[model samples]
Target: MNTREFKDMDLSAYFIGPKGENADIFKELTEKLINEHIGYRQNFNAEDANSISEFEKTTPEFTNAVTNMKETLNELSRKMRSGSIPWTTAGRYLAHMDNETLMPAILAYNYAILWNGNGVAWAGSPVSTLMEEEVGQDLAHLNGYNENGWGYVATDGTIANISALWMTRNVASIPFAVKAVCPELVSDKSDWELQNLSIKECLDLLDKTGDKKNEVKAQSARSGKNLQKLGKWLVPSTMHYSWQKALDITGIGEDNLVVLPVDEHYRVDTKKLEEIIQENADNHIPILGVVAVVGSTEEGAVDHVDKFVEIRDKFREQGVDFAIHVDAAYGGYGRTVYLDENNNFIPYKDLKDTFKEYDIFTENNQFLKEDVYNAYKAIGNTDSCTIDPHKVGYIPYNAGGLAIADTRMKDTLTYYAPYAFQEGVAVPASIGQFTLEGSKATGSAAAVWTVDRMIPLNISGYGRLIARTLFAARKFHDFFNGQKFEVNGKTIISYTVYDPDYNMIDWVYKEEGNNSLKSMNDLTQAFSAYTSSAKGGNLYNLDIITSDSNFSPATYGDAPVKFIESLGISGDEYYKEDKLQILRASTMSPWVYDEKSFNYWAPRIKKAIQGKLELISTNENIL
Candidate 1:
């Protein structure tokens, strides 16, 4: 695709419409979906007697019930319309990780629901099970996984994260299980060496056991023993809360989770991470795994996975190894921005020319920093990753994905259900055996499959959408950084928390010549609450809605010290109160990329802030 083609592409065609502009197109496709399913049912066993007669269809009781259903549906639609966030609108919604789902995904989900296919078992969903597998393969490919890798959809990112932890714990125990079941297989290796085996090494040992694989797994962590041998899991403070939940669920006690501090930019300080890993090794404590976040939930920071790979390799040379998993639920799809039409990763040197060819970025606004680019490129080298289709793939809900670098990882967590597979099948066409979830809706899988088919995951497709969001984020970041307001004779200046690594912008307001961190936190909190719908503020009165988050000394561990001090806040004041509040804006709406829309909304957003500041100055109780 060329720049002109990208510019001319009708992004509006992909949505039902912000104002019903594409309603006719959506209706036509929806009717086609219903008719196609009905036609298939009518064609099957045509010679057999009909289940329902014409008389039954015309019954007054049935007719009345159908009318009541339509009326109830109308009432529900009205309620939803009145209560839902206007996510599809460009300037109205800049909060959270959600956006308007792509039209293809929505329609495909609706179409598949009519059949009610269960993805857990091939017996329950012969057709959709295969489709789900294909969707998994597509995700694996999108994440740059090689041919030996595999992936599958989970309920959501939370489930995916838990599954990764569970797999890691079980795989960590395989060497112990092998030593017990087949002593000869590991007679030369000591317990310490076996405990330190890499994920691949453990799987290789399991393969050598062949028929005894089951016996070995019976003694593994999944069987509820040898868990302590798995040692500690390392994660940055910016990690999602799901990691904590994963620890609780996997029986890897929360105390076993080592929380590393983030650097000034909110990325895991790799130097500190290395020191901790080395300390663990020197202390003879076994290590389970390390999680690197591709996009932190609060700050949109990208941890350096490339640095992680280098550290892992350096340790592996000294007989130390640990699995590396990337939690990319929010930024995985952004990898498309670095890929070519053929899905090959575009080298950093060539990216400038490519951007020029696509007319996507301004000369001064190359959003792909060297660290972020290298982090994304290193995804394929990791053990596994959690990618949410709902977050960045623009797919509907209930479509989170887990991509494994090696397909053998599946065996570590596999379980067989007697009733879910066929007797003669060599490899059962089902996902239940290898997943954390059972009886999942295949409609979510269909939604992913449909979107991947209609819009490729490469630069020509998803990349286009991602590029627009990045552009919008950069513009917003520049706009806010340059903005200032005078209210009640106090000059207020805005500063971004950090230059965005992705599409989210975290910013705060500080009063001129004011060094109090508490006052700054108060002002930002009041501004956020004034513009928020959840704070009992009227949405219609605001020009934009944004989310709010806090950073505290307890949770962030001195990470906010530099950011707080940058605003001239006294270090003593920060230590005294120890909290920083900021407003977060997620620029996932492509419409904000339009110059006219940006111009219209930017001024109004400033006016809203000025109004809030004026109101807060008058009401000391607002804080």
Candidate 2:
């Protein structure tokens, strides 16, 4: 108690609940956790009708993903209470399925309609494929794609990103196809022609030319009549390492990815992006596309989607054929309901009302200056994008998603069944075609459908709930901004302010405002990420609780929007940030609402940070 230099952490009662048997304690607890914690879920607030009450009546039969896993854990907990089943290996004693930690996944299994096939088709349970289609639709709509279109929900963001890269490569070939082919005519013997004729053949023609970049360039102008055009993709430096991974995955050289620097806010530097495009093309590399972010994991920053779109259009006039892919895997669900419904984000010029249109009414429903912010749905206007329901969507784990803005882009990523095999198929992008993945997550599809059913994708509902989390983020940010804690910590960016050009908070050192505030954040985070007994959770991301309302994403959507808008994002370009390690107080859990529960559980986090800091501050035996 004497060494507790960080005073802003008054969460003394948090880890332990108030001493009472009242059921109200639990309800209050859920609210505080929902609004205050910032770890998981679509958000603290419910965003729609279905969202409000997906499970109104929990069967003593367990509802939560973690709860289901704990059914076995509870048995062990009971055994532990009885001193029977001792802690064995955090180990092989459990299997992936029968393992004690399979609860949340099991919860998802029940909803999946239990399809075990590669999930490759209609025969695998027509219902299952139907659900997948619905899940894809939800993802597309949530990430700002057409509401009723074709997209895919896959195993992970890696696969999703890879798929987009595949589409990107195919589309890039369309404009460059002619120029890339003819130079290989010398090597275009019978064996080579038979082995490769399709785009893969053209790409392999890369090896045929042996000239590397020039062969690819010659392929661009195969007829040798004109200079070829191959463009670079401008991406935020804060983007996922996956963008680089895609370069390798699609045979696109790493050198072709034009990385743009970020401003203090972690958004792509617009001026730099324009400069890189013009510079690279001048150096003989046409800019291929722009891949903005919806939710970057490193800093949880949603890039300004609207701004990038403007840049995309301006560059396209030069015949740049710019494709935008939004990496929103961690933040796709930020805008659940469609409050800014008019889709004002399009045409790129009407982003001015972004703050007011998505603003949430505070205490008296009266709008506050602090209450205005940008929207996420408005920020992800990409040719394609990917999102994960497992992370922020509040669904159980493993339900990552991929959504493409242009419906036809799906065709570019597809594999034609030799025209002979798929002779009768109407759609070129069949379930099993085009994708790098073979078997997919059926349970994930079910989970997405079930959750979306609970929370309709309109703004008056789930969108409102999304807004609430923004409120919590701002509350947490404001709380730390003014307080001069004893520890040294820094600002961690999360949420979009809704303004196409503004809204993201910078995470690196901000020396101008307050010097003491920086040290406190540093001190707080130092201890927060430490491990005691060398066991338990680590503070890996900046933690902030939106409010109990954010936890209600499972309930009807109403209030999450205001909070979301305040973070300042739009549907065109996602704000991205570095993967700075920090503690995240997740309100995605419904356990953090009222004063009573706040008294019990909140303090543990504070204590944990303090205790870890103390451990680090002392050399012990060395001292």
Candidate 3:
């Protein structure tokens, strides 16, 4: 390693058990959990109660339960060990799901599950409620939120996304409702006035209209006018399927979803987004909201969030008002770029060393560009943001979160259950009154809190882990893109690794005199798609473990044709069966950055491609 380059990686913190004491930690957590359970049970005298343990001493049911549990546990262990998907930490395969997690998080989660704490309200689980609140505050701060901001954990990214949209939908409709019943409240108001009313103002207007909160909710449930008839939701083509579902659930029909085309880099085209917004306005359709993705699902592209903010502000200056929601489910925590050792945001000048440390500025200047930097920095200004701790946080599954820039956004959606919120407890202290989920797991909150405590959400912690993953991606890209094979000193095949926005690498074979495969249409007709085995036990059979992305006509609706044309290639004919299957590799595994591990795996990746090409060249009916 060159001394001139930056070096600040604390390699020990990268693993689950840095000191190799996983066994001791697991044992300690297990014992503590049992003791806590016993302590709770001891509240009622043992002599007065015939508990399960006592009954089990005399009955066969306890034995039966243990027997069944042991058998199931054994099978679970067997299946997990034999699975094709690489386990976390080994770092061979990466198509989502990182292989490393903090030991504290796991231990804390195990301890919490013993109590089965339901984070519905204070009365239900007081400890978990506090932990959940801390977790929310931590996430809010991590994702660029401030004192005025608020956030909560949900089941996953989809739920978090829908929850944000739900709030946006209801909040946006309040002004129109107020105007309809109490005309005086909005008679002389401008467009921004009608659209940008605070939740309290809208609620006060509803009260002035002689309507109860429940009555307003009831009317909304019964339906007044569909959101599609009201406005359009502008989204990019690279959007996750969750947005489509969000529309349906929010009563905004999917047809009203204005799909913006992606640029060559796969980021949303701001020019087209502006055009569509203006076009919709001219047609008397309001722009309901604009969703900017911080990490696109397929290509990991980060949209220019600052550009979205600028566009919104430009429209706002002209009396147009709309909300911007950033879906950062996959890349929310990547904002670690802004934080320093003390978790304070540093200026761009200071970020250069961080970039240099990961070697990110070498080829992909996109990551360090001003627009990209501002995009991440602008997260604090968005109306709402959806982030999943499971994806990049290395937390256990099913931990998605939604953060609102203003806590007032939650007021309109509040619902209090008579039994849930006990006496003497305030609404703000408990979350059941506002969240979409009712009976949520407190264990998830514990896991996030414990892990984040150990690995603070700063340059020295979460930032370090994420930097390694990104470095692995850069490394994999270099290796995959540099491959040109020869058998017996004769060049047989080469590859064209499609440029990715992040860690996802898509590559296609480049064959000599393959002019017939000039376009995706021609290639699909010639080569049959590769299919994986159904049973799954084999992972390393192919020197490289990769999946395929088939850009066929049926799947993309002519987008593939346009994409191929943009590549300076020609395919005169168009066929529904026209498919362009590209091999994909995701370097989400941080372990790949380890030189020894990467050196061992790099040649295998090449061998996999070379072996496939050799077979194709020699066989007659290989397709």
- Tens digits of per-residue lDDT, candidate 1, 582-618, equal 8998888867765666897788767767777787778
Indicate the TM-score of model 3.
0.84
Per-residue error (Å), model 3, residue 603: 2.5
Write out the backbone clash pairs for model 1.
none
lDDT of each: 0.84, 0.47, 0.66
lDDT of 3 by residue, 1-623 (tens): 32321135444443554234456656766688788787887775766755456666667877888889999999999887566444453444544445556556666777787776687887778887777888888878876778767788789999988888888787777766555545676799865566655444555665665544445544432245434434678877778889999989888778878887767566888898888887866666777788999877666678999989888888777666678899999878878856875567778876776656544343343434566668888888788899888887877776888888777677667777789965346554687777889998888888888777667777666776776666666667667554666643444333433455455665555443333343332232122232132312264342334455565444344544554544444534335346656655556665565567678777765665566555544542322
TM-score of each: 0.95, 0.60, 0.84
* lDDT (C-alpha) at residue 170 in model 1: 89
**Model 1 poorest ten-residue lDDT run:** 1-10
Please report the TM-score between candidate 1 and the true structure: 0.95
Model 1 Cα displacement at 325 (Å)? 0.5
Clashes of each: 0, 146, 1
lDDT of 2 by residue, 42-157 (tens): 45354634443546546454466557787988788776555422111111110011112122233444535333534666554566667787778766766656643457777878
Clashes of 3: 1
Candidate 3 residues lying further than 4 Å off, grouped into runs, are 1-14, 17-65, 190-229, 354-367, 422-428, 487-498, 516-543, 552-579, 594-597, 611-623
